[model samples]
Target: MKQSQSHDGSNAQIGAPIPSWKVLIADSQPDQHDAVGRCLASLRHDGRGVECLSAFSAREATALFGQHPDIAVVLMDVGLDGPAAVQRLIEHMDKATATWAGPGLRPRVVLCTRDPDQWPERAAFEATAIDGYVVTAPMATDRLYGAVLSGIRLHASMIAQDSSQKGMARVMVSTAGIFELRSSHHFYFNLLLQINSLFNIVQDSLLFVVGDSAPKDDVARIRAASGRFSALRNQTIAAIEDPRIVSAVREVFQNGRTVQTNEHFAFAIKTRYEVMAVAFIDGALGLSAMERQMIEIFRTKATTAFSNMMLIDELNASQKAAVFALARVAEYKKNLIQGHHKRIERLVSETAREMLQRSFHPEELDEDLVAKVGVASVLADIGMMVVPDQVMHSTRVLDGDSVELIRQHTIVGWEILRDAATMLRGRSILAIAAEVALSHHERMDGSGYPYRLVGDAIPISGRIVSVVDVFDALISDREHREAWTVDAALSWVTEESGRLFDPLVVKAFRTVVARIREAEPDWLATEIASPALAGKITTAKRDLRRMIDRITHLLN
Candidate 1:
């Protein structure tokens, strides 16, 4: 006969403890109080059961954590009345697991928020460190149980990975306390000095950006340490992107978002020539499991760093856009070409999206970046504005002086964009645009100007525009040149692929050109040169197509 365990008048089977599993419940509501206990009482794995712990408030939750280091899973309410805490005690516990705890600790967390979408908690949940989330609603017990089981399995995998990297020597400490490790601090500083021996490790490079105010002192320590460890900090800063990776690191610290990598982000970083690492630093440092109390502390520091990194991408994009805009204005004025810039923008955008879709094995062309590529294309000819009208329109070959002034536009574009760095605070895509605007004239063989940056040194945007810009220019009737037929221009670009263009970009251009032709047979010859004006027509066509597709799919 089977035994039955009683909870809230419901009976659940109870057997021996589940191997490699322990569960904790951190909630205040009586229903959750009853339902969770009943659910836990029923849990079984391979016919074995679970070791369960329960807590009602944030404080009790902490006590439960103290006693049960092997707690594999936690069901935590997002809010707990612990001195008006900005973050739930569950978050605090989760942070502790990831950043400070050793093996036999580091519980996987499941957040149960009443109104998970409100204010800081919502942002915290999105950015915070938790294995999974379940909104408190009817039938939420099922969701809670599933999330817990999944988190436990994943956490076990992470434990395995950390176990593999057990031999690496590193220090795990609080944000401020990190500097206290004299040898590591000294080593970090020495690395910085070797990279740049200027201004004795500038503190400006080491500034921290915090997205939340609750960890005010945490932010202060990271900031305050700059003055004391100026050398170490400056070196760290020099090695980091501006706005600082520290800001993102801090947000992650306070919130503790599960750190996962996507191919798009991975590719973007590589395309931009950056090296990024996500690590379980605490586990690597040989910290004791009881020392898991420092999880929150590590998270705060990591969040600041991560935030700063994201901010850098944003800033870089903004600066690029401003520069491109300025260049476009100059180019438009130079030839009095009203819509030439606009046409280029459309061509570039269409080509890039198509190219990204085709060449990237994982087509992760973000919709946002696709729009940005169009904007960059529109501004690519802006540098041509710095050239005099006579030279711009002249069919005659240019003199040395005229060529020299024209070559200065890339630098000019960069200069005009430097002041509007704030505009770039959140968009990294624009920076790629700026690179395209400034370097579109560059040849694959290092024959381009402003910076004779060859091969991969030239931004992908620059490479992309190289094919699009040239094709547009060849097929458009500019002041000094007769327009070539679409077929002629296409053949020219396709033939020049590796010699004058990125081969992948050239191939993408062909596909886009084909798409445009299929979409509109006479599109190339229609002569809608002004992109802003043509946009309305294009939008209408897109809308109609979407409607037709929806109707067709529904019928199918």
Candidate 2:
């Protein structure tokens, strides 16, 4: 006997064939098969009824179990064959189901017998992986129905668990892929997008960074969003129009737990660096238990990934700070003014930004590259630390040997930075700094020192820093020459555009100088006394003092 079922229940079309769970009855007696079939004919679980399959002997039962691996329940008669035959059939079924159906889909087995003394419940359960037992003499219809129903329910639960595990595995793989993205904004956005996709939910989701560390505002702020909440990205909690959503997010953050209702679901994820909240709008209301479990697993993985990303960010910031401090030490040893490196940093940053805006070296220019070159500009003359103090501070004209000794600073600086780069595993900022240290003295016409890298052979970072470093030096007072007027310095740079500088770089430098003049008409006249320059000078002094104190403490 077969029974059919439909997902739509009574609303399903009449007479249309629907899927059903398969229940196999293995018994030598035809009457016993009929009786068991009649007992389960009207039974249903999870909107699906059972279909009965019969096998008359142990051999036939093994074959049937193999053929219908999807069968959810098996009613085995212990007396159909001898006890040894029954044991062999059970073994065959176990092996077949494990091989053909996999972990969660193996059918439940209910052993039936007329002799309860021979096959005691404890012994039957201890011997085989049977789910239930029934006595055929009494043949209670309710007991048979209950056994079949329980088997079907257990099978459904296992399948759901198996599916959830697979879903989570895929989510983990995708999470790893997204972590490869460099930008935090893109990382969070794709994370929310993946969560929505995994559950086949509407893309209405929002991820918020909670606690006082959030940028722009200290309170919770939306860092990533999709669907109708897209415009709310980077906005504070007050920007969300839905009061319920706001409340739920606050609850999660305050309690550090998950909150779920019919209309929304929100959870808090705490990392070593910050607290975060992920909320799904309306889409999470109707998810199954398996889906909820999967979401929990995804939440844990995302927290770990987010925490690691934060740690990387912190490490990068620390590296940049260390690089700047090293450059400052060289500056102090050279006895340069407190703000000289800071001014070079500003000029290089402005020139690089201008070059980027003009689309110079489009293949190589980006915001990250611009920032790196700017920070690296301070290290251009780090090799000056190797110059003899007498030659470095000479008031009179230097002879050829003195000049040669000073020029060796470039190579020395390059080696210092190159070794540092190696120590850092070739980090890009250090690599760029090494390039600047090596080639800042190289002129466009191959007349410069070190390698004399001519024209485009010079790394763009080196080229930009070369022009700015020379301009800064030319306009600053030195023991050998009085400070040149801004006009004189500009005239020299413009005249040497192609001969000594990359013409494109000189053009961008000119724009940068123009912007500087427009912003501070008395910039050179005020020199280090200008308000903006003074602020930077004070900060440099403080940082230098802190570095000196740290070194002194270490020595002590």
Winner by TM-score: 2
Q: Give the TM-score of candidate 1.
A: 0.38
Instruction: Give lDDT tens digits, candidate 1, residues 327-409.
Output: 43454355333455666677788877786666542343555566566765565555565667677657778889888887886
Worst 10 residues of 2 by lDDT: 5-14
Q: Against the unseen true structure, what C-alpha lDDT does each candidate score? A: 0.54, 0.76
* Steric overlap count per candidate: 42, 0
Model 2 alpha-carbon miss at residue 85, Å: 35
Candidate 2 lDDT at 439 equals: 89
User: Which residue ranges in model 1 land beyond 4 Å of their true spot?
Assistant: 1-331, 334-339, 359-371, 426-430, 526-556
Q: Candidate 2, residues 456-555: lDDT per residue as tens digits? A: 8888888888888888888887656678888789899989999999888989998888888999886644132233443466567687889766654533
**lDDT for model 2:** 0.76
Best candidate, lDDT-wise? 2
Q: Can you give the TM-score per candidate against the true fold?
A: 0.38, 0.60
